[model samples]
Target chain A: MNLREVGLRDGLQLEAPIPLAAKLDILDAVAATGVRRVEVTSFVSPAAVPALADAEQLAAELGRWPDLAFSALVAGRGGARRAVAAGMADLEYVISASDGHSLANARRTTDEAVAAVPDIAKLAHDSGGRLEAILAVAWDCPFDGRTAVSRIVDLARRAVDLGADELCFGDTIGTTVPGRVTELLGRVREACPDVELGVHFHNTRGSGLACVLAALQAGITKIDASAGGLGGCPFAPGASGNIATEEVVYLLEESGVDTGVDLGKVLEAAAVVERAVGHELPSNLFRAGGPNRPRGRG
Target chain B: MNLREVGLRDGLQLEAPIPLAAKLDILDAVAATGVRRVEVTSFVSPAAVPALADAEQLAAELGRWPDLAFSALVAGRGGARRAVAAGMADLEYVISASDGHSLANARRTTDEAVAAVPDIAKLAHDSGGRLEAILAVAWDCPFDGRTAVSRIVDLARRAVDLGADELCFGDTIGTTVPGRVTELLGRVREACPDVELGVHFHNTRGSGLACVLAALQAGITKIDASAGGLGGCPFAPGASGNIATEEVVYLLEESGVDTGVDLGKVLEAAAVVERAVGHELPSNLFRAGGPNRPRGRG
Candidate 1:
């Protein structure tokens, strides 16, 4: 199974702006954990998200680890151009399924966002890059309440038809449960059978890891997690960080699944990010440590 | 499906001692949430568990809520006698399945602990109380590592033969995953088919709720949870609280499983406990609020 680390882009987007040097240190720690794929940063407007304003410079530093596979998140044609210009061949474009989150997050309607995806996909393909369309708020929306499964299925089909190579579902508010995860994966897969699928879940409501388990049971291998469980939707109030990478690794590894990532190194990386963030990250494994440690009286 | 609130006993056993007044207030809040059963306190030695030193006083206050079914935890004959004397008809007796933890937590071998159950059960039955044998460290032990499923099965049979009204497996150090949860439940059920089965899981390894899901899917309904996610084992190092009640209710209610408890009232009760504890509880739902709350840009 492939575990993609999104702590840099999705995780840091909500925190106060740290220096480029700190970002490099975190990236180095992340790479040292043997996580080959990382969402390095986003090409969003610098004024909108100052935390990731140094996306280009950080992307420039990717040459330090030529063996790692790096991807960047983009919102539109302009961001896509910047990602490709920075020599990144894998771009993730997010389109919210709910119009409420769409307008709030992308400043456009869901249809308008979908319309922009075809051009972005063409740009990515023309530049010999791969485009992954991430359907945000695919299960439940903050403003729209429960999202319609048909909306996600329709978007998945459209993204696949628009030359996108992969698709993912983002539980934007972390309100989804395992049943909904199974149903959505079934519907999306029925509609777009051959597309590689992934899931991005936040631990907002405590079902994040449960939903991840359901996704894995449904045969999904690509999972998006943040180091130290960093990152939340700045637009979604009460939302917490994405599922912690260290916790996910521990869960999968303990279940006899081969993640190929060093659990200790991941914890080390989480410690580095936690120190950089200057607060406790929302990772139970990071806080509790691993299972093999010595037991003592509390 | 029945959800038993163990925050007062299991949750508070790790926190600094709070007064009986605070405990009563928390109980009132918990009863208001429509939770019918609660493990109010434990009858262990005060020197061993000073946090629950007021077991007699706490049990005496149970008359305030006659509609709620209350239980107390006991380690052996002495604690069970105290529980019955204090007027609690339901008693939970804990026995460690692994000898390593059995020696540490109960200061006896697993066989010696099991041998005490018949006398405790006779006392409980003679006093018109029911005995729930809680098998601690059923899946993994801190010192002994992964416990043999046969050990748990053997103990379950012996506890049932000794007149245990119900059986529960305690993931003492919280090192279990969902697959292990399913396997243990299946094996134990195969051994004791007619006995009521439940699970007590710690979120120590980040799989508590997932294990809950697995147990629920495996046809077990009763679950043990802590309010505000407070509590950890003093003997089990690095272990956190049991699965949070609010998170369990949220997961069940959102998934169409009616837990018969009001989510809002549980959060209010959690708020009261959080104030009494003077620290953040580990419940993600308690911290994030319910799913229907308003959303705003961060």
Candidate 2:
């Protein structure tokens, strides 16, 4: 299974600004977990998201982990060009499925966002980078209420047609339940059977990990998570950070699913993130520790 | 689906002592959620658990919500008598599935605990109460390691034969995953097809709600949760609170399973719990709020 670590990018985006050196340290810790992929940072405007303004410098440091596949999140054609120019071979282009979220997040309608995907995908492909179209707000939109599964299906088809090498559904607000996860994933899989699929969930409403369980049962292999459960959508209301990578590792490894990521190393990375963020994280595993260690009276 | 709120009893057991008046206020908030059953408090020696030393005083106030069925946790025949005397018609008799936790929690071996069950059952039955044998540490025991399925199956049979009207498996250390949940529940259901089965999970490992999803999929309807996700076992090492009640209600109701709980009311109860405990609780829903209302920029 491919567990992508997005803490350095998504998680740090919502937190207080840490120095580039601190982010590199976090990257080293995340890479040490043996995870195959890491979303190094996002190629957004420095003025818009100051927390991730050092995307180019961060991308330049990616050569230290040749064994790891690193990706950057891009919002538009300009961000895609910047990411590819910085030598990032993998890129994730996000398009909110709902018009409300799209306008709030990207300053455009969902139709305009869809129209921009092809240009961004071409830019990524032209620069020898693979594009993953992340359909944010795929499950529920804070402004639009419950997202229509048919809308997500249509977006999945469009993304696949637009030269996206991979597709991921983002439960932006973490309101998705298992049944909805299964149903939506099943529909998308049927619509784009040949496309590689993944899921991004928030622990906002506490159904994040449960949705992962449902997705795993639905035959999904790629999962996007953050160290220490950091990062919430600045645009999506009532949202929290992505599911904790350590928690997901604990869940999968204990259930006999090999994620190839070391749980202890992930916990170490979470500790590093917690310190860097200057506060506690939302990860239960980070607080409770792993199962093997003795705790409480036992 | 019966979602039994255990915040007042199990949730408060691990926190600093709150006055009886504060507990009644929380109880009123909980009852307003429209949940049908609640584990009011545990009937134990005051010296052993000073936090719940006022179990009798709290039980005396149960008459305020005659529409709600109330249950109390009992460790032995004495506790059972006290609970019955306090007028709780629903009694949960807890016995650890593993001898390690059994000795730490009940000061007896599993055999001795099983032997004492018939007497406790008779006490509950003679007083017109139903007995639910809660098998604590039924999944992984912090002291004993992973509990064998055969051991749980054997205990389930004995508890049913000993006159338990219902059986509940407690993931005492919150180590159980979804596959194990389905497998264990399937085995127990096969062994005790005639008896009602339930589950008690802590979010220690962040698998609690995922485990709840698995149990619901396996057709196990009775779930144990705590408001604000409060509580942890003092005896079980590395344990956390039961799955948060509002989170479960959000998961269930959003997934089309009618828990008959008002999510807003449960969140109110969680707010009351947070204040009484003088700290933020572990519930994600409590922090993020529900799906409605505008949040963030959206």
Candidate 3:
């Protein structure tokens, strides 16, 4: 199983600013944890999310770990230009399935976002970078109650047709259950057998790992996790904590699923984020190993 | 799907002293939530765990809710004697598959505990009561790393042979994922086709509800949950928070499974438990409805 460490970009998107030095340090530490891929930074405007204002600086300095595959989130053609100019090879474009969420997220409707992907993908490909489309709120929309599974499948089809090398379904609000994961991801996988499908889940309902299991059973291999369960969904208020990478590793490995991630190193990286964030992270396995843990089996 | 509310028994067993009056009030409120069954109290010795010392008092007073079926945890012959004496009809006799946990919990070896179940069942039956055997640590044990699936099945068969009316598998450590759950529970159901099987899970590893879905898919109808996700496994120290009543009902009902539980009333009961425990409970849906929630899809 492949877990993309999104603790830095998607994680810090909602967090207070961490110094550039600290961000790089966490990036280096996360790479050291044997996470082969890391979503380094989102190339959105700094004014929109000031915390990740160091995206350009991070992409510049992050050439330090050439062995680690790095990816960034780009909003549109302009953001794609910045990411390609920054010498990043993998770029992720974002859109929402529902028009309400699409407007709130990108100030455009779902049709507009889909219509723009071809140009964005062509621009990225012209610059020698691979583009993948992330369908945010694919399962549950913050504005709309439940996003239709067919809508997500249509987006997957459209994204793949528009040169999306891969497709990722983001449960931005963390409200997805196993059955929905099976239903939606199953359809997406069926519609696009050659395309790679990934799942991004939040642990607000505490079913994140379970949703991961359902996704895996449905043949999804790529999952997005934060190092210390860091990150919150601003839309789904009080809905914070992506599934921790360490917790995901524990669940997968213990269930006889081979995940190349080193759990011990993931914990160390979690510690660094905990200290940097200046608060306890919401990871279950992270706290289970801390001083607050009573004597017994984990 | 039938949810057995374990908040009053399995939940309070690990908490600080809760006055008998408060326990009865919570029990009344829990019944008001439309839960058909409630594992109200344990018949263990009062000296062992003082938190549940009022079990006999609760059972004596709880005859008020005859419309709601009640069950209790009975350790051995003595506990069964007391349960039958209290006119409690449904008794859950427990033994761990791992000798270490059995000794730590009841000061008896696993085999010794199993050997005593027939007598306990006979006593309960002779007194017009039905007895069920819960195989604790059926999946994972704190002291023992991995409990063999064959050993759990053998125990289930033995318990059934000893006139046990039903079989329940307890994930006392909350570590069982969906695969193991499907595999082990599937085997148990096959090996004991005549026996009704139940599953009890903790949310320690955050796979509780997923395990529930897997179990239901495997034909299990009985589950144990605590209101507000309260309660920690005393043996599995870090294993706090059982799958919450409201959360389970929401998941099941949303997926088109009939749970027969009132979600609105469960939240009300959760509020009462939150106030009595003097701390916020660990349920996600419970907090989602509070001040922390933002306007969006559930």
Best by lDDT: 1
**Candidate 3 stretches greater than 4 Å from native:** A233-239, A290-298, B233-239, B290-298
Ranking under TM-score, best-scoring first? Answer: 1, 2, 3
Between prediction 2 and prediction 3, the one with superior TM-score is: 2
lDDT of 1: 0.86
Q: Give the clashing residue pairs of candidate 1, or none.
A: none
| Candidate 3 lDDT over residue span A10-110, tens digit each | 88887788899998878878988878989889888898888888888888997688788888998888898888888777889998889988888789999
Tens-place lDDT digits, model 2, residues B7-57:
888887766689999999998998899898999899988887788999989
Task: Specify the CAPRI tier of model 1.
Answer: medium
Candidate 2: which stretches are off by over 4 Å?
A: A233-239, A294-298, B233-239, B293-298
Specify the poorest-scoring 10-residue window by lDDT in model 1 chain B: B289-298
Candidate 1 vs candidate 2: the lDDT winner is 1
Better of 1 and 3 by lDDT: 1
Candidate 1 stretches with Cα past 4 Å from truth are A233-239, A294-298, B233-239, B294-298
Ranked by DockQ, the better of candidates 2 and 3 is 2
lDDT of 1 by residue, A1-298 (tens): 8999998988888778999999999989998998999999999899999999999999899999987899899998899999899888889999988889889888999999989877898888887889999998888888888899988899999988888899989887788899999999998889888999999988887888899899999889899998878877443322477888988888898889999999999999989998887877777777776656532221
> What are the interface RMSDs of all the models?
4.0, 4.1, 5.2
